[model samples]
Target chain A: MKENYYQPEIECASVETLKALQDERLVKQVKHVYENVPYYRDLMDKKGVKPEDIKSTADLHKLPFITKADLRDAYPYGLLAKPLDECVRIQSTSGTTGRRVVAFYTQHDVDLWEDCCARAIMAVGGTKEDVCQVSYGYGLFTGGPGLNGGSHKVGCLTLPMSSGNTERQLQFMTDLGATILCCTPSYAAYLGESLHEKGYTPETIPLKAGIFGAEPWTEEMRRDIEKSLGIKAYDIYGLTEISGPGVSFECSEQSGMHINEDHFIAEIINPETGEVLPEGEVGELVFTSLTKEAFPLLRYRTRDLCVLKREKCSCGRTLIKMSKPLGRSDDMMIIRGVNVFPSQIEAVLLNEGYTPNYRIEVDRVNNTDTFDVYVELSPEMFSDTVREITDRENKLAAAMRTMLGIGPKMHLVAPKTIARSEGKAVRVVDKRKLH
Target chain B: MSVKQISVFIENQPGKLAEATRYIAGHGINLRAMSIADTKDFGILRVICDDPEQSAEVLREGGYITNVTEVLAVGINDAPGSLATILEIIAKAGVSVEYTYAFLGTRMEGAFMIFRVDDNAKAAAALEAAGIKTVEQSDMF
Candidate 1:
């Protein structure tokens, strides 16, 4: 069967054709970076490699990997491909460590981004008739505008509702007969809570599909969100540096997110050794934008670690599918010489009937790493006595020990006592210096 | 004849009530009488104090959400049927007492009871017309 959606020349393009397209684009991007971005030029010169040496996509391995620190070094606007006036739109990522990293996009870049988004929407069986309610934030963030423009490209009735104001979001979802919703998975969970509070059920909102991403979510959360909202939740993945939230998407099969390989090449490489790993092997994900115009990336190492599967999907797209990112390299906490991800703690907390609000404090006591978890009890569990609380905390400690190989001291705090962020939740606080 | 009353919304927890009372006491607000109406989720802490304004402000600022309401502080005789007489008058006037608790007055001749009803103004007026003295904010403080 001939796939109408797949571009014949690109999707089924021969290796020679693919390499030619990549080479042309790669050379242009390299020259652009060398002329405009001093960071990339200096890094390339230090590695004793010239842009011409990267003649094929496979030769991309010769290029130095660009890390988040490189982006930080460049800071705002230091990596732009075009002049400031030519750039039409910009999006920034919330830098947990310092100032936000801003990405620039020309009109052409925006069109390509929207096309990628439209493809993502189509992957999940969304059509022009579907009403897309975009609940992702619009200002300074790539999520809202990226999905909004893409939904528009797909000829859907787009609602750029943005985030928060749950009452109004529900009102518009019901009033406007919205069918597709987009937002962070956590916000989706909160929306489910709001719907229950207002005595509304799955039948209340005309939602049939959801594209959730921006933050790490587990399969358990996906199930909860799907069951609560009565919608098929598909994971969409992207970063502002690459082109925002339409870089890849999960189809109706829910197998994995299919990367748009024609535009962006996805590679899994061993994070420690920087060696490319074979398909199905878990490693850090790296991408080289083959079609991006405004700020084409060359081997940008997204610290997100995941595996890729090249088997043909039931969705008939020849693109590569990536398993959900486990966690960022920087997000992994070394407690007592054992690596622990906050997501693991979160999963344990969710199953333990504790509220998701939590804080992890790491200190050095007696010259050893002492991990203390401050968990907020749910409203139902607030009345538990000190004995009961201690028992539950001990149970959590045991579970953490079994799961993470390092037991942390548990501190039960009152509900809503932990600080809440309007953006990403800060998970780790290292206080070894105080010791 | 008058007594101060304060209403507070307290989430049902082990130490919330103690914490609220401690906060009020720390602010120098003398507790006159208190009662509570509780469900599984939350409880209403109804308190009569010597300084209603100060008590309410302290509780509110301390994050113990509370409201101040006027209630009749009738000097009921320290004997049986005195409480029944006041309640009967309220029931006859079509007012339902949601909750009530008593505290001994400075003297043994009377007791001050704090009542929480649906209609505070109507209950106060009806009790006053029945020859009962309703407390003002200044009278108790």
Candidate 2:
């Protein structure tokens, strides 16, 4: 949390200098994409814009916005700006949403990506003396390898303990004295619960900090994990389309994640009209990779709805900071004329002292939307009478109703009744889709 | 005196009950009496066993949400009116019974029933005052 913990030269760069650097990179990257990637060049032609028109960040709006749909249309090689021989690695999305997006990275691109991640690790006080354990899924999934490379760049002793094999994760974590952990937020919470079940307290573990991301997690969930694991939990943000797990990271301030503006340019746009929005407005987050060679996405729409902040941070980083995503614009579920994100339900539960492991079941019966939440009770909360338990359910329903602006029927089931996941937890069951 | 009863939370799925019982059986524990309270979405499996501590630990280790509760077990005559008589006595004493389950006692001539009440000592006193024999942990095992 100290002011000069990380690379102060880049993180604390002046706004004037950062903007000038971005202006230079924007001009070169625009021409590079137009000359090499035919798919993007065609998109630019359709917009009646040329690479010369985008001379700086001011003219960035003139370029056509690229989306995941474009990535899918192009498929594997359509977006590559460099030759296949020049690229050293390719990381793909899980294809859970649709077609997997494979991003090619040249050795230069990989080095820059790892440098960004190294800055993140350094921001969290990770040093060479620390043993960093990377628990994100490895291989085609970008989480593990991205952080693994980043931890190495930071000069920390790295433990490439890819996800699962949680028992062994704990063993190595304790045996080797891992001081930093990199994994998804849900997996961090799962590790906390597993440690508690094994009768290990925070003092028994040597982890001092954890960088959790790859999925949207609430601030309340962050606090819960921090308390359970007895360490500071930091949020790291990235997507396969942009880079990997280190596009931005939280400093000791923990207010928001500082975007690596030197390598990527971020903008907010109205998702419907595709018109750019001014700073501080909540809209779709779009990023243009300025330094990536093989796969440089120009104004790629991230689909994550959040606000961008330019206010000077306490950490002294002038880089633009982004709030944790509210929810993906597409993942926002509409039930009974109300917009509900699973995260709102999670925040409500964690505030009410329940674990974040829950299922939101939305159904429609006879033209009416049925919203029910199945919550797994902790062991302490499971022994009450039926009336007492029902009363608690009603209280939770009222709390969620107040937060979500709609009432959802709440069921407090026994502990572990709902499934526990080792990966991204499935939290919603929309039965209306079946009908 | 009260007896130790282990209650586990189980989903109302097809194999949940079998899974829980098999887990306890695998630990070599014998159940003295067992009952399940069912709801549309889930069920609570309550059991009295030869070793309640071990039973709870085994079920918890098997990933079941288990709790140990104190309940008053009363031995009554093996007649139709025996349960009704005890229920009325406890009702008059103002001790509300949250749930109750009965099984044949170790003795052939009578039956043993368990009552999960708000206050175990109060329920035991009320049942004993009415000449009903409230069983102890020793009586069950």
Candidate 3:
């Protein structure tokens, strides 16, 4: 068997060599941002700093932190390092909260992004002979095009199937003999359910591996997807602002996502104080584009909470490894002074063998946030008696109490009772009636 | 006589019917007669109730995930060949019946058969033109 394409680069590169490469790229990136992007220059000047004053990665801390609100304030192209005419492509955020923050990419930037994604694919033992099915949607949304370009660059036959229309996607997967699949983790679960509904087995499609990302998913979800699809699932992390879907990826070992530190610098910092945190501790993830020319962000706060490890991975990659993201800093719900994340609830539900179709109803009852978890029983578990249903609901409540440290009222609903989102799942429904 | 019937997609598990009934009673809708067609994965709960529209609304409000489908409630004599006559009329109209069940009318003088046909409007029209008493939404309950 041929060795993995990324193995040699990861195994052979020394710590000294990797640091030297990062230092050179950091200097060049700082100079380029100061000269080309007015936003960086203005922010740096306000802090009494010049591009030449910064020397190494340690000096990067003196710079002001860039928040998502800053990106929103700048709007579409105010932060681009290059003019719009020179840009080759652009990708936009979902804009679920506010205005969409668009990221521009020049031709060289696009090539580098594709190269990183190709390296990621190769880390999972993907070969040129493999057929990759890109189901992440092709539009201004970055995922579909990013994976499609990378798969093509890796010399694989790429299928840009995009998202939705599950039946048609399955038909193509079977007929095309796709070997590698890429999409959000939630969609993979839905596809698995669709396959079961259609009476198809795992052998029906020729899928050996899957790269799931675009939303925060738990380890339980990973196992569920792997078991349902009968394929090894790897997590890929990226934001459109930095580079599409190839900022970092997990190797076949599945320990942590290996960051391409040569192109992008990863840091974990205290989200509240903007103070840098020690490695191996969970904090907000921040990234700076070292090689991107079109839109090289300087210390962009990703709002995702995760820990980083600089020790070499078993895959032999000198690149830094980041633990799977826990949750978004902004999306955390404080219920009765207890911080709760929907992902935590999802993990508990999966472990209890319940389908992950649940809605968290938080209502202000008697001046307190009362939580009601409306969970839908699987079609196979539904029965004709109320006693059996309440018994199952009690079991779910017990599991939630043990896992979440607090148990809310549980309601057993029929299958498909909860509304399904075509994109991201709506996890929180706060009915506090805030005026 | 005609009866108002509602067809809902129910999962094959315990307590689902009781929950549905609780929701219906909470909304003050009376259950007249009901039958369930069960398969391995799903069960179709066909009900002839006093107020079907309100009953469906209550089920939906309680988050039952059901769909309201129009089914024909034909008055069949409690004798042999009565259902055959209605099926023959429906077949002649090029309508295919998916599944069906029988229910006792309110007065107990006759039997009413609920037919879940592919084309509800066409089948109802054919049965009415053939002089069979086709139940309407208002005539049910």
Candidate 4:
């Protein structure tokens, strides 16, 4: 615990101390948003809530909840809690589904965010002696900047590789003896394959640990990447709206990520009702940025589906832990009175010896939702007879039915027909939305 | 003896069979005989071709999913009930025939039938013992 934890005082803080800190920060943040941001102020007034109404974290439910739709409607400066001159930087999400989410940060907010990231790096055994390579794309993307700042705070010699350039990436990784690799899991998998093709085994890989996130990856993939890259891959969770990639991180226990609850208060709520669920119940994740000064959000609905539990960890940190997000609520589709997530289909596909890359096409005809998934036929799983191939397709569909509680029509197409995911793969094509 | 046959996976759409066969032909591989076993949405284009291993590899490089299977190449009388007789022998051997197609490139006079059975060794032995001529991989080329 001495070398593992970065801020033992805050990380290992007692429940009472953590609650008092959250109650204080939540009160201050509500007041700050109510006084400065008119959008949230208007929301509060509509809800008949005032800054005085929220006295502590217990009163957090009294405040109006903000959603992604609200953020988009607020657009540029509508959600700002501070003046433009005082703000230091603004990071934006790719915003593939909706309008870009631009999060503002003051110098103090940046420092606190970096501190959160530093705690993550240290949780994965990152140190000043380690050469940390940040391969997550920089610019508007928060991954590169977040990990880079954290590496600096930890005093590691930072390599801001900023994604792509595989040849040079391998060169620098081997030559510089980089110990920590920070990137998306897909990129890490690609790098591991490239390294193998270039005659470098997992034993020859210089990285001892990896901080992989910004996308969902299965535990099996994590073990595979760990074996291939010769590193203990760690999961780091964050969103651009909630101060980027250090909002929560995995400790040595590896059960679930310990959310930096001191800075960002994480909660689970039912997506349909907005009722707060009890701890350990899976629901949509709601984050209230308690310490974000420039863009302080109050009970912001993240729409990320997960579970949070505050169990006593062997790592000795009392921060409440959040399970790796099951799937985003936005990615869910209802068919024949049954809800199916594309991630569920993906899990079934992987379990059946197929690649996770698939296209889920959903259409509604005559008031019935038609669900179809196009899974690519890899060379390794090919068979000569139509019965043999059709048997596989039937088995996959049955597994998906068992997993999702709804059966989807399975199409086994030739490989290279489906588009591969580079960063975030668009897996769903919903025709119902079009109509 | 069993002959190597390459099967290419093709979606049941326009020009899929042409696309797969063209890929192998473009790689200078000559096709001997082929059959399409199709379902509602997809089909397997099974082919007896020159250089079966090389043809499958070429199709794979062209991004077509291919599988190689060893099938019995038995030469039978080019008359009525020839296929029935061979299948009866296979059934007597307690071997189930999965699929069968004609081998058009047989250099002899009799009709050559390709048989993919549950147990190739048992079926091949029974057919050969019943005076059916079993072709080898070199016999076609």
Candidate number of the best DockQ: 4
Q: How many clashing pairs per prediction, in order?
A: 2, 0, 11, 0
Candidate 2 lDDT over A305-326, as tens digits, reads 8899999788788999999887
Candidate 4 on A124-237: residue-level lDDT in tens?
A: 988898899999889887889999999999999999999889999999999999999998876888888899899999788678999988766668778978988988999999
- lDDT tens string, model 3, A111-192? 9899888987888778889999899878877789999889988899998899878888888888888888998877888887
Docking class of 2: acceptable
Residue B140, candidate 4: alpha-carbon lDDT: 79
The better candidate by lDDT, 3 or 4, is 4
Model 1 residue pairs with clashes: B2-B135, B3-B135
RMSD of each: 12.9, 16.4, 12.0, 16.1
For every model in order, what is the iRMS?
9.8, 1.9, 8.4, 0.8
Give residue A124's lDDT in candidate 3 (0 to 100): 75
iRMS for model 2?
Answer: 1.9
Docking class of 1: incorrect
Please list the residue runs of candidate 1 whose C-alpha ends up more than 4 Å from where it truly belongs after superposition: A1-20, A196-205, A332-435, B1-141
Model 1 has a clash total of 2
lDDT computed for candidate 4 = 0.85
